[model samples]
Target: MRNLLNFIIRYGRWFVFAFYITISCLLLVSNNSYQQSIFLTSANLVSNSVYTGASEVTGYFHLKAINESLQASNAILENEVLNLRHQIDEYKTILADSIELPPVAKRFDYVQATVINNSVRHPRNYFSINRGAKDGVKVGMGVVDQNGIVGIVNVTGDRTSRVISILNETQHFSVRLKDTNFIGSLSWRGGDPSIAYMEQVPRHARYQAGDTIVTSGYSTTFPADIPVGVVMNRIHGSDDNFFILKVRLNSDFRALSTVRVIKDEYKSELDSLQSFDFSPTK
Candidate 1:
């Protein structure tokens, strides 16, 4: 206790001086309006800078979520635009039919769906989407993206659906050459996602490299004239009756993010009407 008293006695004057200096500074700022205003401004600026830096760091960490939200929103807008375009085409068809009495035009609707999982490296590949029966998705519905037709939905649940991708070897789609309208069956060879084989194209048909291939609308899933791919190459079979042409697909399966599920409102009625002609003549 005596030692502490001696130390305090030794430094007491310096401590008193330091305390008085701090009190004097506070009194001067409080009494002087200009000095107080400057102090407040400086403190506010430093506080604002710190808050901005923290906010920027937080926002940087949230970029991925923001981008995903934007992609989902974009998917909705894209579906709406496609729907409007289809409506316009329908109106045009109606006008043309009224004038010339042509065949009835087919109609289609699209439901926006996000791709939850996809695979492009498998022989029998399938993709899953974030929509199902609860969202009006059903089996046999066609799935597509902005580029072109993707696949057909095969399995469905309340909130999820599975699609048999066009890249699958077992999945076949009917397509026609854009230039000659020669119909052929499109199937994958389990090679590459960007390539498929078009079979049963007659040898006599005019075949050209780079000619566009499009959906033939033979199936109730995809609409007519939807682009599928372009002819990449052609090879003749042993029988020489038909040519197997290579097609470069329009949709890039590796980077798929969003897609649309096509709903044919009149599919059941059409199927019922066409079911009576199933028997073939021998």
Candidate 2:
């Protein structure tokens, strides 16, 4: 107690000065209109800057959640568009045949997933998503991003799945030229990540440099008409009978973040019918 008293006594004058200076500033600002206005303006400026900085920090943390929500909404819209197309086709069939067919069932389901891991530089490049068998993802299910097709799910775990990326050389998609409806096999040529080639398309397919390529929907793996890419100039390295047209992919594989796993509603039935053994038997 005696030592504390000595320390306070030593600094007492400084403390007294600080207290009077603060009081004088307050009184002077309160009595003078100009000073009061300046003080309020300075305080408001500091508070606004603080609030803005805090808001920016909070918003930055919310991007992932916002992105996931947006992806879910997009999935719903895509499904609705597909159903509308089916209705149009059904109407056309009824008009032509004068026979009422049963309502066309929904053909595809989407499971939104985050791309947990990815790579594009490797030859057999693959990515893993945060969904798997537990989330209704399965082997051979098609995966697509907001832009377009990304890959095919090749392996599935309980809570995660691995996808063979479209950038892989060994991976090929059954895609058709949008205008001519000519189907061809598309695969990455191993050099450029953004470019692939639609191989074995007939030379007389009537495609231009900017024709769109899309899924053929010929198999249960993917639904029809999902945009794959746009045709670049045709390359001269293939056989004379077929044109190998370069395609610039729509989905940016290098920046993959969110994707959807596609489920064919009647995949099991189709697979069973296609797999039945029809060889000669005794």
Candidate 3:
């Protein structure tokens, strides 16, 4: 107690001066309207800056979760859109059937799936999706994004499927020139994922750079007219009477996340027809 009294006595004058100085400053600012306004504005600005900085730090930590949530929401919305489109197509088919018109070819049925893993720089590129037989995904089903075709499903289990990307050298797809409808086979040279080569197009076929290429719907997997890529370059083959065209793919395999697995209702029928050959020589 005696020590406390001695310390207080020693600093008493300084403490009084500090307290009075604080009071004087407050009183001066309060009495001057402009000074009070300036003080408050400065205080508010500092507080806001501190708060904003803290908020940004917090948001940075939450970005991954936010992105995951956004991806899930996008998947849900895409499924709904696919359902609506299928319904509309069904209605059109019904109307045409009632009128005795020829049956229109079924294009594709969109089934939303998340990419579990993807690769771009590889000779035999493949991607795994978080959907399989349980999710109605099957082998040979076509996969695509809003931009264009990705690949064909090659392996399927109960809960997941692996897709052989169009970038794979072994992968081939039937595609056609958008303007001329001259169909050709699309294949990757195993060097670049961004580019593929279209072959079997006659040399006489007319093409210009930037002409769009799309799926030809000759196969049971992909539908007709789905955008594949744009023509980047064309060169006449030395031995064959066809043009070897380089195409820039629409889908970025490296960045693939969400995709739609197309299920055709008439796939079995189409497969049966494709297997049949009525050649008289045979």
Candidate 4:
């Protein structure tokens, strides 16, 4: 205590001088309008910059939640679109043949999922999604992005599923030219990830470059008119009677991150019908 008192006594003059100096600076700024204005401006600028920085940091952390929310909202909208299309199809059927054919029922449902892994360079490219059996994803379900068809789910686990990408050589899609009923088969032919080919299209099928190709609805896997690509070029096929359409695929496989799995609600029913016993007992 005695030592502390002695130290304070020796430095007391310095402390007093420092206190007076701070007070003098405050008085000078308060008395001078220019200095006071500059001081307030600098303080507000620093405060705003700090606030903006903190806001950006907070927003960055909220991105994942925002994305998931968007995905969920998108899924609802897509389902609504499907229902509307189904209604349109039913109306068309009623208009076309009221006495014979019945209205077509809704056959597909969509499950939105995020792509965890994707590869486009390989000849048999595959994609991995974050949804699986637990989320109702199944083998043979068609997968598509917002732009177009992406792949088909080939394997499923409890929480993950692997898809056979449309870029794969083994993958084939039943596609047709937009505005016409002429159907063809679309497949990848090794090389460009952005390009695919539509085969078995008759030479007379009236089509042009920039014409859109879409799902034919011939298969039970995908719905009709889901966009696949745009026709870029047409060439003589191996048979010469058919034209091969060089298509620029709409789905960007390199940038793929999210997709929807198409669940054909009637697929099992169709499969069962195909397997129905018709042989007469001997």
Per-candidate TM vs. native? 0.63, 0.65, 0.62, 0.64
Clash count of each predicted structure: 0, 0, 0, 0
User: Between which residue pairs do clashes occur in model 1?
Assistant: none
lDDT of each: 0.78, 0.79, 0.78, 0.79
lDDT of 3 by residue, 1-282 (tens): 999999999999999999999998987556423222322321233433453455444435534644664577579779999999999789988886555569886556789986656677877777767677788988789999767899998766666677788988877899999967699999998877798999899877898999999999888798888889999998676747887899999876766666899999889887899789888893
RMSD of 1: 23.7
Candidate 3 has which clashing residue pairs, if any? none
- Pick the TM-score winner: 2
lDDT of 2 by residue, 51-107 (tens): 345544543554675577568758989999999999988988888766666998988
lDDT of 1 by residue, 1-282 (tens): 999999989999998999999998987556422222322321233433453455444435534654665577579779999999999789988886555567875578899986666678978777767677889998888998867899988767666676788988878899999856699999999977899999999988897789999999888899888889999899776657988999999887876666899988789887888886867789
TM-score pick, better of 2 and 3: 2
lDDT of 1 at 207: 71
- Looking at candidate 2, what is the lDDT of residue 43? 22
Instruction: Give the deviation of candidate 3 from the true structure as CA RMSD.
Output: 23.6
lDDT of 1 at 126: 77
Candidate 2's TM-score:
0.65
Error of 2 at 174 (Å): 0.7
Better of 1 and 2 by lDDT: 2
Candidate 4 lDDT by residue in tens digits, 1-282: 999999999999999999999998987556422222322321233433453455444435434654764577589789999999999789888897645558788768899987666678878787677676889987788998877889987767666677788998977899999989899999999899999999999978998899999999887788988989999988788897898999999876776756899999899988899899999999
